[model samples]
Target chain A: MYQLTTVTKRYQRGKQTINALEGVDLTIATGDQLVVQGPTGGGKSTLLQMLGALDRPTAGSVSIDGTDLARLSEAKLTKVRAATIGFVFQSFNLIPTLSAQENVETALVPLGVKPAARRKRAAEALQLVGLGDRLRHLPSELSGGQQQRVAIARALVKEPKVLLADEPTGNLDEDTRDEIMGLLAGLWKDRGLTFVLVTHDSSIARRAPRLAVINNGRLKVTERTP
Target chain B: MFFTYLRRELRRRRKAALVVALGLALGIGLVITVSSVSTGMRDAQDEVLHSLYGVGTDLTVAKEAKAEEGGSAPQRFKIEGREDGEKASETDDRLMPLGGFDNLDDSVVDKVAAQDGVATAVGALALNDIKFTGDFKPGEMKKEEGKPGSGGGPRVGGGGADIETETFTVMGVDVSALSVGPLSSSKISKGANFAATDTEALKAVVDSAYAKDKDLAVGDKVTIKGKKFEVAGIATADTGASTSNVYIPLAQAQKLADADMKGKVSKVYVKADSSDAIPAVKKAISENVDGATVTSAADLAEQVSGNLSTASNLATNIGKWLSIAVLVAAFLLAGLLTMSAVSRRVREFGTLKAVGWRSGRVVRQVMGEAFANGVLGGALGIGLGLAGAWIVSTVAPTLTATTGGEQPGGPGQGGGPGGGGIAQQLGEGAQQSVDIALKAPVTLSVIVLAVVLAAAGGIIAGCFGGWRAARLRPADALRRVE
Candidate 1:
């Protein structure tokens, strides 16, 4: 579980301070599937970064499983991030040089997993994402949908407590988006995992158990449609 | 864990690794080759000096002009200045009352013989411009016989061309008398026991030359300046002081040069009881026999050793500069490879950071990759360097000369002749080359230096690449499409 209390992130640009996140508050619980929806530059990515502990809040506290993000050392935070959070990006973010299986195996590196068992687990994760036969292919050789699936598989390979996906379906076609969404939901349901997804699609937002709309560095809760 | 990272890095950058390895190999190879040849040259010089000079003489005392009543002492002697006041002054000094040269009388010799640590003291005399005539002819003299306005025709067969010869003072010892130090043995082209003190052996050589030419026989006459003496015996001298000299009995030589005036001899050659006694003998001779110069085989050896030290230092410096050049080239090649790898993997590094890998880990991976390539490259380079050294030593002009192969006369020659005579050609080819090879050992040190240099170059290049990769921000890195 994680909570953001009145978070405000500011960037100094010459003589002005740009507010990326302002007075934002949110809470995420175990097994909760929440989607944060906003247009480009609407602070959707910044909010996700704060929730995942990738970026610290500038004005407020972000506590993940009761540990404050602002107080943790960089090394300790890296450990926390590795063990408790997994990331999926719109561009897939799979290492272009590594095979689909190796991209997944990279997530297991910080866990001190042995190479053989890491490969086995990576294969299983890829199979779960319906990419069992594309394990040896590079990201460059894969389509946008398949590459995103590999990214999702890499995110799940480490079995982190929380999965943070920023625009997971932004690069996919409508049919591919539906398929990827189904796979994400299936993983959440089967493993009882917490997922904080950032998307611009209202249709994708309606499928989540909860929806939070962020506008101008501020977040407001909307009714759960599903 | 490190090896796994290293392995992956190598696999990912095989082409770059290959290029670095090849570059290192060429660099190391050149280093080894040059070092080996230089060392070989130094060693050859040492061998020739030992054979020619037998460690050399320790000291040479000659008349100093200051010892004379009213002449300034000259710093050095000049062969063409006998008529100069400097020569007259030096001769006067030898005859001065208080000078050490005057103290070399017979009483002085007896006193030095009685002194502690004194060894056998045989008198010696030295003269230049002596002429010898015989069935055997000397090499053609290059000096001009007469001035243009002298109006004298070149002297013909009776006088023959005046050949300058160096004559040594010889001691009248029996054939069994053992010469000590470097003079114990002689290197002669033909005829054995030519150094014998036995009158019969000496007479035999003299008689044989006389049979072919009347002027060369025992009792036959040869002239030194205007003084003529009956030929007594023919003898060969020791390698140390024999190359340009002929010797006769000490008493005879002194008598011929009028050097026994005041019952004194020109110089004395002292033979130590053993090698260890040489220093003590030299010291006693110096202290007791004031006007005479005392020399030891060991002192000569030290001079040779000093020369060897200088040569080795020069060689080592040359090798270091060459190795530095090689290392720089290797570093440049390695840097280029690293940069290329980094450029290609910008996105990969970003993805790793985004996946929560620390900057340190990414840097470690990059360095690990570089280290792996470096080690492999260094090893291959060392092997190539050794091979190159061998090839160079075998094919190099100086080495080929030392090995007794004939000099390759021109570019068109397929190969040159081979044998010991060829070594003589090498001697004439380059004086410094022979000196360098004669004194130094070439193989082991050169190889070790080359390998170490290559590895160090690699590590430096790797660190540069690692620093660049570690500074990249994940957000910005990910934003790049490629």
Candidate 2:
């Protein structure tokens, strides 16, 4: 569970103080699926960064399980991110040099898992993502949909409590985007994970049970039926 | 996983890695070559110094001879049979007190030996034996007709003379302390060295070259100053120049040179307790012993000139600085290139951090790649260094070193007619210039130094790249890439 209060993020761009986020309050329960939707430069990614513990808000309290992430040291925040959060980028940011299995295994490395077990778990995760036969393929060898699946496998391999994805389907066509969304939904349901996704596609946002629409650093949440 | 990542990364950037390695290799190879050549220079200098003062001698004490002090004097030979009305007469003349140096009392040796840091002090006399054998005919001098503007003088008519001069160096050794003089550097090639009992036995040691020239051997007799002496041994010098043509007992040399030279010596060779003690001993000898001029091996090394000295100076000055400059440039290049590599991989590192890899881990990955490059460079550099040193030793020309005769106004300079002009012509036939073959020997220490330098270069480059990686914030990195 995450509790964010009065979350404000401000940055400078050529002597202009742009408010990336302002007075935003949010709560995400365990096993909740939240989809954040916004246009370009609309603070959707900034909110997701706060939730992922990848950046500290300028003036706010972001709490996970009653622990304020904003008050934690950088090293402690890193540990929290390593153990509890997994991130997926729009470009399917898999290591270009690593194969499918090795890219997934990197998520388990920080946990000090032995190499043999890490390999076994990574192979299983790849198999779950419908890329069991593509374990040795580089990121470039995979198509857009297949690369998204590899990214999903890497994000889920660590078995984190939360998954944060930024524009996860922005780089794919309609057919591939629907296929990736189906895989993510199935995995989220099976594992009962808290999944937060940032996207600008209304088609993808329509499927979320809760939608947080952000514009110019302000947010509004609405409930809907999937 | 770390090694696997490092290996893959290095393979992907093989060309850049090779460039960095080759740069480092060039610097390291030059260092090794210059170091080995410097070692060779030192060895050659030691060889030359050993020829001058022998191996055991640390310093030599001698008093400079003045030109007008009878150090060199014209010799008068009595031509007999002139009163018997003989037209032609053959004369043989032998001159002593050779090499033209004033003698010092034997007490100076005792004084030097008693000084602090002095291990042993022994004295030897350096002499030159010149024999003149020729025919001389007596002729009458008549009054010469004077030209209108010329001076009138008596001139000899129908007189002719033919003369032949043979000269050789002789060193007198004190058999009791023969371990620190000219004879100390020579090895007995035939027969044996001077024994204690041969101090007054009229025994002599002939140099190998001198013996070969005169067809003399052990047990044969040679005439010196009208005295026949038995040859006890034939000796060959160790390096540089031969010591002397002959070695005889100090007592015999004194008797032949002068009747009043019973307890006098021309040169004193002093050995110190240790190399570090040499300077102090030299100072003490100079301050306490009157009129003594001390010459150490270091002093003689400074006087060396010609190709060997020039090469040695170049190796120490230009060669050393050139290696340093190349090494510094290589290190800067490596550091800059490594940092640039880290900059190019910012997104990859940021992704790793988001997936829970610590900053230390990211830095280590960068450092590991840099270190691998360093190791590769080190291996290649060692091979190149060995090859360079080999080529130097094989292809370098022979170097010649000449010692300076800078003791001005000293012996034999102002001798009247028939006197040799330079001391080199009289003093031990000292070959002022010596030829030495240049050798570049790569010792174990030089190899170890090369390894250390290579490792240091790698570590320094790694530090440069790792610092860049460790300071990167994942969010900032990811945002920059986006």
Per model, the share of native interface contacts recovered reads: 0.33, 0.67
Per-model lDDT:
0.60, 0.84
For model 1, residues B1-482, the per-residue Cα lDDT tens digits are: 45654675677667778888777766766666657656665554444443322233222222222356663343232233232222211110011111123324555556655656555544333322222322222233234455887655543232122223222212222233224212332333334332445433322222232223333544555544344544555433331223112333434434444233434443444545666765676677677665555544334333343344554465578765876687688888887778678777887787777677888998888877776777777778777766765665565432211211234422111111111111221121111222222422346666678667766767766787888788876655654632
What is the DockQ score of candidate 2, to 2 decimals? 0.73
Grade the docking of candidate 2. medium
Candidate 2 — which residues are off by over 4 angstroms? A132-137, A140-144, A173-175, B66-72, B87-95, B98-101, B140-157, B175-179, B186-198, B201-204, B208-222, B228-238, B258-260, B406-431
Tens-digit lDDT string for candidate 1 (A66-95) = 999978876777787778888888888776
Q: Which of the CAPRI classes, incorrect, acceptable, medium or high, describes model 1?
A: acceptable
True lDDT of residue B427, candidate 1: 21
**Alpha-carbon RMSD, candidate 1:** 12.4
